[model samples]
Target: MKLLSEVEPEVKVSVKRIDGGLEVKGNLEELGISEGTELTVVATEPVHVHAGPISLRVAGKETVVARGWADKVYVERGGATVPLLRLEAGEKGTVGTIEGGKVFEDFFALLGIEKGKEIEFLRHLPDDTLVLKIDDHEISMGEGQASKLMAEHGGKNIQVNYLGENEKAKISKIIGGTSLKEKFEQMGVVEGKEITLVRKETPAPSPKRGTYVLAKLGEQLVTIGRGLAEKVWVE
Candidate 1:
């Protein structure tokens, strides 16, 4: 009976008990970690990613956003479409594509990062996050949530959470079948959102260990703080 976070790497442990509420239990269960679930711990290292500020000029408007906001914002550079993140300062391109699916499209659409829009990587601003490790199967919200989150991957309908670690899926539909939709919506877990299973933990650590994420929507900028950022995925 020990906290997964406190466990040393390479030690095999079974989940004896999970300390928390239903939300915690549910999140752990989704990752296939529960009582009696035996798993080998791997070297856990904290990985941090910082998003720099990306200045953009959109339709005569000037705005600043976290570098993450421009990740999916594609631009035409040298007749080749590339991520907006690759553009250097003073580089300009046409909005050739808005990837990451409908939810992202709607987000970028509101920011005017759509087709035919002239975009410029005005400049980059600086800014300054964690991930637990397992058998390379980072825990992703699984089981029930995965069951409810029916996603269309490779033309097949599947639960988003049930996906293996590092497995990515696009949420095609959310069938809460009751109040789950509202619950999922509260978390912004909606269709058109792409979800990825990162890592899993035993004894079910906190649903959120406070991972920092910077999400952006083209020229429309907003800063998302921690806590809430871990639970919400941009795509």
Candidate 2:
């Protein structure tokens, strides 16, 4: 068993284990070594190995591993691996398990990272520049810095319920641009009308507080502040 970093480039080797570490033996381009990379052994007449989920074939006829190393190396496809925290634009790859011990796993978990989660690499590090959307609302995270915001999302359903009176009407004009509040008004929500909170469901730890009622009028739906809604004195 040899650590990928410890092994010399182009040395014949094989993988011996995958838990808590990766073992491989082969004539490899060490310069290409990266965390969470997948690999496979050659079988049948085609003497070669495949790497990554896409199974990019390596060590073809020209570069074959010694049979001794081939039998010892172990590899898995879509097995347990942690995705690395990517900080570049358009840079994408799956995660493999951490090379270190339990401490590494715990620390990564604190960063809201887990195996098998697909993350979009972002370019910046501050001011919500990294774009990630939950439930279709796009939010900006600090550029390349989104990886630090760690939390787990246990699947949960949050249902939004509508209440209060409602007035149905079509929109005739829009008062503003595409802001949520503006769109509501353009949908016939306006002052002096009543609407109910519609149903909404989402996972646990929902960022939204609760549902809202819209006042419908002309071609717009005017959104009233929660405080103002309480004072509406609905009849």
Candidate 3:
């Protein structure tokens, strides 16, 4: 077995043993690193590893070991690991682990992304942006954020935005803040609720204007701005 810091880039490895005591082992475990776990070394300088479905890096460190803390992680090469951002269009993966702390985890959970969920890589846009199909939503994210996710590839899903007038769909997720979520929730826009597109008005001839969409939620008819409509994911 070799220390994780010594593993060459692109090598697939499995955790053999962690030589650290309770504190270190506990911390590593929180990041999804432990004996029998498989991962891949994605980078050497400022070491980064794809552990399970999460991508981790030694922040501010030139190597994987920080003050010898991570050196205790001994590994043997041979296992599968892939970062979500590396997946090509038409490919898919199941979320395994999330690399950050509670706050980051909670943030993503609110967005309907969590461990065991499957995501489909849609396509890449200009300027390091990419689209991912999560549930029935097409979410656009930056490359940096995508790099933090790791997954087991091979799944499929379709996501869309526009809907024909009078078309109905079931809400899957809402991407917005607490107030926005609360506002939508009060109008019966919560996940699993069916909504119907009543009417859509094209944007006015103004640089600072947006399209307007009328939707029916339960017994109520709500007028949603273009920006808010895009954040409401549905099937």
Candidate 4:
């Protein structure tokens, strides 16, 4: 057995146990790293692990780990594991699980990705980017963002940004803290709500200025800041 952080790149391993108290265990579990889970070491410097249906950054030289925390995560070499982000174009796999908090889960779920669903991996574009075919739609994502998904190839599961001007789409997900979620929800930006991008106005000539987005949410017209609008995922 060995600590996950100590595993070599491309090595496969099965989690034997996670040694930590409730808080520690809970945090790791949220990232999909737990006992009985199988994964592979994608990298070591930042400690990337393809845990189940998600890829995770476990530990690193700059990351502080509690005493005995990493050691508690013991693993046996050689297990089945694959990360969705690592898949090449033309490959396909089933959605296994997602690693992250409730907000992250909700975000992906709203985008039509969830456990047990089938997805086809498209080609990787420039700037560490890639595209995925989910159902009848194609969603593009960045590599860093895509690494959080886990899947099995021969048997795997695994696992968004921006909208365009003058485009109409249904609300797929929102990415932000509680306050942001509530703020948008209150503005009728909840998932499944159809919205249209009316216009993007330039920032006013003032020190406290910012760009604004005008849109139609249902029967009402709404305006949102560009920063916040970027967090709103549309399909």
TM-score top scorer: 1
lDDT string for model 4 (114-219, tens) is 5566555444332233444333444443433333322222232222222234344554445444654564454454555444434333323334334433332222
lDDT tens digits by residue: candidate 3, 1-235: 6666555555666767765465445445433555775666444331122111222222221111111111112212123345444444555566555544565456455434556666554443222333443345444533322232322222311111233444455555554346546644554446555544444333233343444333322322222234322332221
**Residue 91 of model 4, lDDT score:** 54
Pairs that collide in candidate 3 are 53-150
User: In lDDT terms, how accurate is model 4?
Assistant: 0.39
Candidate 1 residue-wise lDDT, 118-198, digit = tens: 888776542211121223333344232344456667677654433566676777876423456777665666678666656
TM-score of 2: 0.20
Maximum-lDDT candidate: 1
Residue 214 lDDT in candidate 3: 31
Candidates 1 and 3 compared by lDDT, better number? 1
**What's the TM-score of each model vs. the native?**
0.35, 0.20, 0.26, 0.31
Question: All models: lDDT?
Answer: 0.52, 0.27, 0.39, 0.39
lDDT comparing candidate 3 with the true structure: 0.39
Ranking by TM-score: 1, 4, 3, 2
Total clashing pairs for each candidate: 10, 42, 1, 15
